[model samples]
Structures are given as C-alpha cells and as structure tokens.
Target: MISVYHYMTIAAILFAMGTYGVLTRKNAIVIFMCIELMLNSVNLTFIALSRHLNNMDGQIFVFFVMTVAAAEAAVGLALMISFFRNRESIDVEEIDLLKW
Candidate 1:
C-alpha cells in the first residue's frame, strides 16, 4: 500500500538531484531545467500532503506555484535567448551582461 511517506521520499530525492544539478552545472539551460525539477518536486509534495490531510489548501498553493513557475520559465528562456544572441554562449561563468 503506497502512502504519503513514499511520495514524500520520492519528492525529496528529486529535489536533491535538482539542487545538485543546479549547483554543479554551468550551462544556463541546464540550470533552468534543474530549477523546474525542483519546482515539480515541491508540487508533488503539496499534492501528497493535500491528499493526506483531505484539504484543499496545499492543492491551491500548488496551483499558484505552477502559475509562477510558468511565468518564470517564459522570462528565463527569453533572457537566455537574448544572452545567447549577444554572447553566442550560455555558459554561466562567461556571462557578463553588465560589463562592456
């Protein structure tokens, strides 16, 4: 019988992987993907807890979080595209948008 604990554990593993990828990856796109992964893990947690508690609050919060994540992905992708156009590379270490 699967339970909330199982879901929570899976989410925790996913979050950890995302965190590690974000910390170690140098590519902006990869980092963005990792961020998305982390967000998804949080969503999983929220859904699990919402079901466990038989409440709507966690689900409601997940809805808002998804909305924000969508907006962030759009803006982040746009910025990455613009940066790539300017520098011809998306390496995090090479980004110097503020400098001439």
Candidate 2:
C-alpha cells in the first residue's frame, strides 16, 4: 500500500520541477507543458488523499480540475496558434510586445 506521504512527496517534486520549468524556460510551449505538469501533480495529490480518506469528494474535485484543465488547454493552444501565426516564434520573451 502506497502511503499518503509518498504520494505527497512525489507531488511536491513534480510541482517543483514544473515551477522550475515555468521560471527558467524561454519557450512558450515548454512553459505550457510545465503548467500541465503542475496540474497533474495536484491531481495526483487529490487522488491520493481521496483514497486515503475513503471519500469521493477529492476524486470529484479532481474530475472538475481535469475538465477545467482540458478547457484551458484548448483555449491556450488556440491563443498560441494565433500568436505563432502573427509572430512566427513561440519564445516567451518575444511576447513582451504586449508589455505596457
């Protein structure tokens, strides 16, 4: 039986890696992937807690989060496509054009 602590540790590591990728990567796509990783880490934690507590609420919340993530990914990818068509590059720094 996997312990909750183990699940939490793995989640923490994954979230940390995602955070690092978001902070240090210059590519917009990579940052998006990192954000997905972070979301997945949270999902893992949710599922683990749901099982440990013998409750369906955490699992239900995870389902909602996944749904939102899918929607966000769709919209985000559409925006990325538009940005790429206009700029010809997916570098995060290049997006400074929107900076005030």
User: CA lDDT, every prediction?
Assistant: 0.97, 0.95
- List model 1 lDDT by residue over 1-100, tens digit each: 9999999999999999999999999999999999999999999999999999999999999999999999999999999999999989999999655677
- Measured by TM-score, the strongest candidate is 2
- Per-residue error (Å), model 2, residue 3: 0.9
lDDT of 2 by residue, 21-96 (tens): 9999999989999999999999999999999999999999999999999999999999999999999999989988
TM-score of 2: 0.95
**Runs off by more than 4 Å, candidate 2:** none
lDDT of 2 at 7: 98
TM-score of each: 0.93, 0.95
